[model samples]
Target: MASDSPVYLLLGATGGIGSEVAHRLADDGAQLVLGARSEDDLDDLAAATGGDAMPLDATEFEQVQAAVSHATDTYGGLDGVVNFVGSVLLKPAHLTSIDEYRTQIEKNLDTAFNTVKAAGRPMMRSGGSIVLMASAVSRTGLKNHEAIAAAKGGVTGLMRAAAATYSGRGIRVNAVAPGLIGGGENFASQMSEQILSSEAGRKQSEKMHALGRVGTPEDVAPAVTWLLDPETDWVTGQVIGVDGGLGTVRPG
Candidate 1:
């Protein structure tokens, strides 16, 4: 990337949606700092996209700091960030354990907090953008999505508040609330045999979207990339949904 080219820090680079966003930004000739816990996945993605890979554990504060520091050094300054670290626990609210709730909160909220704090450091230099991964569940209710929904709600709130606080300093904060993005091992891992096997469950999930199909990572990737682009200079402090009109009628 040239001195004038935008630099983007992409967290959760191993996941389906994150990888797509990284590729999208790279395609637009943006310099990328890809962060994920899986070194091999990060290496492969970075190599394929001509970006640098940073093995970062989002939960580890120092690790995140180090990765962002490396990105700032390599890119000369930060221009944008896409945080995609999130986890989901699928269980009825009554059956969900406290530990399971904590896991989702830690994975979604804390990881995002760490990445934003770290990335905010160098982003201040160039007046950058920050895109947080939220969920349609944040704005709507669901059966077994309690933990993730609560955490993502917090994420959306955090992004809005951060946007207000940071905009004066030239950093824009926003969130993408996606529907059921069908790609990524993360989403597949959340799907259960019980849910797939039960006809009612399948129908309920499928019908929630007006589009009659679940979302794909590719479907949500463009929204994430566009929000992080410098082109969206005036857009900030908003939680835009990538769902296919689910939030409008059926709160999927």
Candidate 2:
């Protein structure tokens, strides 16, 4: 029941979850500005969803700023922004290289930081909602998830502080922490290949979730869209888990 045709700027729009969010928002009567690293991919998505597409590298502040400015200018103003940029590094801290650690920080924490800073600047005068992607690992201790956990943990902290700083200005900032979402072309594909390649491995992963299964991009898009919707104007600074109980429950 979304109205007003709110304008939303979406980063990582070509990714699995981001694509789903774009389609969901479009169906909700949203006007979307989609950003991603590949112009062709963005173009395809834009064509499919009737959204505007731009090439963006979220880690770069200037590019992010440009994308935000474009959205604001094109739509007259921006009503929301969703950042889907992130990376997954599942190596032990001792085994992770400095470069890998830096990459993780840049992809997760830096992407979120730059998106907030750039989007916040424009949305400052006219308040809007901002949704960021966090991970269940940020709150749960998972083996070999040291690097990504640390990075997404920073994202959670950033979301909270930004929410607090902007709430009074009518800006709402929140995050969605997802567990192992399969059927996506992302870093998780590597883990999915290993964890879902065998029947036994698949069962082991399914048992990790109370729901007895992993998630999909479709399962996550609704929560993100809800956060962006006007009805949730009162909710901010919250980290919601769309993890099928993976972060909270232990199957006995």
Candidate 3:
């Protein structure tokens, strides 16, 4: 008989990246707790994947706590938590408002904070994977990405710090910094705009990477799965870039 599959808690399951990750994990035979602000979206994802679904507002602490409890209570334990909730606020930094700044920070960074906190209890008890989504722009400068860059940079920092803090407890924390992943709702419109606006825009963006194309959710999900696998027990405190050679390029 096959071994019982471990369960994973997937936040932001309604999102393009999060949904892709959820499907990939499900295909690999993981039971899941799918959470998002939209009950409709979560319900649809859960039905499609045969996973448990819960409506969660990552911005609300009580909601996150409740969601985590539901997952643990339902599954007996959670083997991983993917903090894939984030925002990409693109605009001139000076044009950004105090409210916008706060909202951006809360939307992108605080969700991770609360999710990690709420999930840590079950994760520590069982020794599991904790994956946070960072971004290549956290370390690289891109126009109109100041707010998001700052928020995601905090995520990278949290990954390293949490990895160090939680290692002894058997909870491994890691991050994936992806550059220009296509087919996600977050970037679909912008990507389409950029791709169709001009041949020069497409060429310039592609030339920025050695791989000559943008990445996809599938391109990034494997690394996450590997990191969470028992095979990678020795790997921790690492941030892998799924940036399609973008990080390795030199400006000439």
**lDDT of candidate model 3 versus the reference:** 0.79
Could you tell me every candidate's TM-score relative to the true structure?
0.91, 0.94, 0.89
TM-score of decoy 1: 0.91
In angstroms, how far off is 113's CA in candidate 2? 0.4
Q: Model 3: per-residue lDDT, tens digit, 1-252?
A: 112788888888777677777888888888888888778778989998888888878889888888878777777877888877776676779999878888878977898788778877777876888888888778678788788888988888888888888888899888888876665454323434555357786677677767887777778878878877877888887888988777656444
Candidate 1, residues 1-252: lDDT per residue as tens digits? 335677788888878888888888888888888889888889999998888898888888788888788777776788887888887667777898999999889889988888788887677766989889888888878777888888998998889888987888899999998876664365322433345446786677678888786777888888888888778989999988888877667543
Better of 1 and 3 by TM-score: 1
Q: Which residue pairs in candidate 3 collide?
A: none
Q: After superposition, how far is residue 231 of candidate 3 from its true place, in Å?
A: 1.4
Q: What is the full ranking by lDDT, best candidate first?
A: 2, 1, 3
- Model 2, span 66-169: residue lDDT tens: 99888877777889999998877768999999999999999999999998999887788879899999988897898998889999999999999999999888
For candidate 1, which ten residues in a row score worst on lDDT? 187-196
- The C-alpha local distance difference test score for the whole of candidate 2 amounts to 0.88
> What is the Cα-based lDDT of residue 60 in candidate 1?
81
Prediction 1 global C-alpha lDDT: 0.81
**Candidate 1: segments with Cα more than 4 A from true spot:** 1-4, 184-200
User: Which should have the higher TM-score, number 1 or number 2?
Assistant: 2
